[model samples]
Target: MDFLELVKKRRSVRAYQNKSIPDRELSKILEAARLAPSGFNAQAYKIIVIKDEKSREKLGELAKQPYISKAPIILAAVNTKLDDKYSPLDIAIALDHIMLAAAELGIGTVFVGAYHNEEIRDFVGAPNTAEMVALMPLGYPADKEIAKKRKEISELISQEKF
Candidate 1:
């Protein structure tokens, strides 16, 4: 599919099928994140791939989003550079790459931002210096039909200034 079509097809998949993503597909998704650009080329981040059923369940509970547990994998984006202002942005770009790659591979993903950060960090065994920026659940989507909703481009941009 073309890039624009891919972008349009990408959706925040909440309902996932009970199927495992192939290792090669997972690798491609991670590779996309690995190639994401970072400030000063300092890719100070780590992606924790959670596959254990119990861990996924606990993470869902911590995030107060039980649906997250349905996916076969949960990726936690961690910023290793707490003092660097660009750390969060770098992680966000990486996560976006992961999401787009997963969508292209017929895998589904959802960006999860609201969660018990400290607990999640501890659960993932991340050091105190690291901060868990976001969580993403990945799997084959159970619901294929997603309604795309967005504002007009005119409402989102200006000629030269905001």
Candidate 2:
């Protein structure tokens, strides 16, 4: 799909079906993330694919989302080399790639940003030196949804300056 169409179609899916994601599909999605533009090519992001139910449950404990464990797959995205430069922006761009790819595969994804840092760090085996920026619960959505309500462009945008 075109970029605009893909962006328009993307939604933060919270409810998911209990289906295993194929390895090839997973790789393809990760490749999409890898191809995202990184600041200065820092390319400091890494993703841990959590297909283990126990680990998912553990993460659910940290995030307090029962569906996280039931989603059949979760991607723990972190910045392995976060520094004074551009790690957060790089990770966010990477996440956009992953989410768009998931949308292409008819998979659902929720951008999970609220969670205990220590728990998330342990769950993904992230180092104390790096920061975890995003978590995504990936699977077949139980029900498709439109995006949450938003302000109009006029309310959100300015001609040149605010």
**What RMSD, rounded to one decimal, does every model reach?**
1.1, 1.6
What tens digits encode model 1's per-residue C-alpha lDDT throughout 1-162? 899899888899999999998899999999999999999999999999999999999999998899999999999988889889998999999999999999999999989994339989998999988888999999999998566789999999889788
Specify the highest-TM-score model's number: 1
lDDT for each of the candidates? 0.92, 0.83
Output the TM-score of candidate 1.
0.96
Model 1 residue 20 lDDT? 95
Name the TM-score of candidate 2: 0.92
Per-residue lDDT tens digits for candidate 2, residues 42-151, read 79877888888899898888877777888888888887775546877788888888999998988889888843376788667888877777779998889869678889
Q: After TM-score superposition, what is the CA distance of residue 77 in candidate 2 from its true location, in Å?
A: 1.2
Backbone clashes, each candidate: 0, 0
Clash list (residue pairs), candidate 2: none
- Which window of 10 residues has the lowest lDDT sum in candidate 2? 114-123
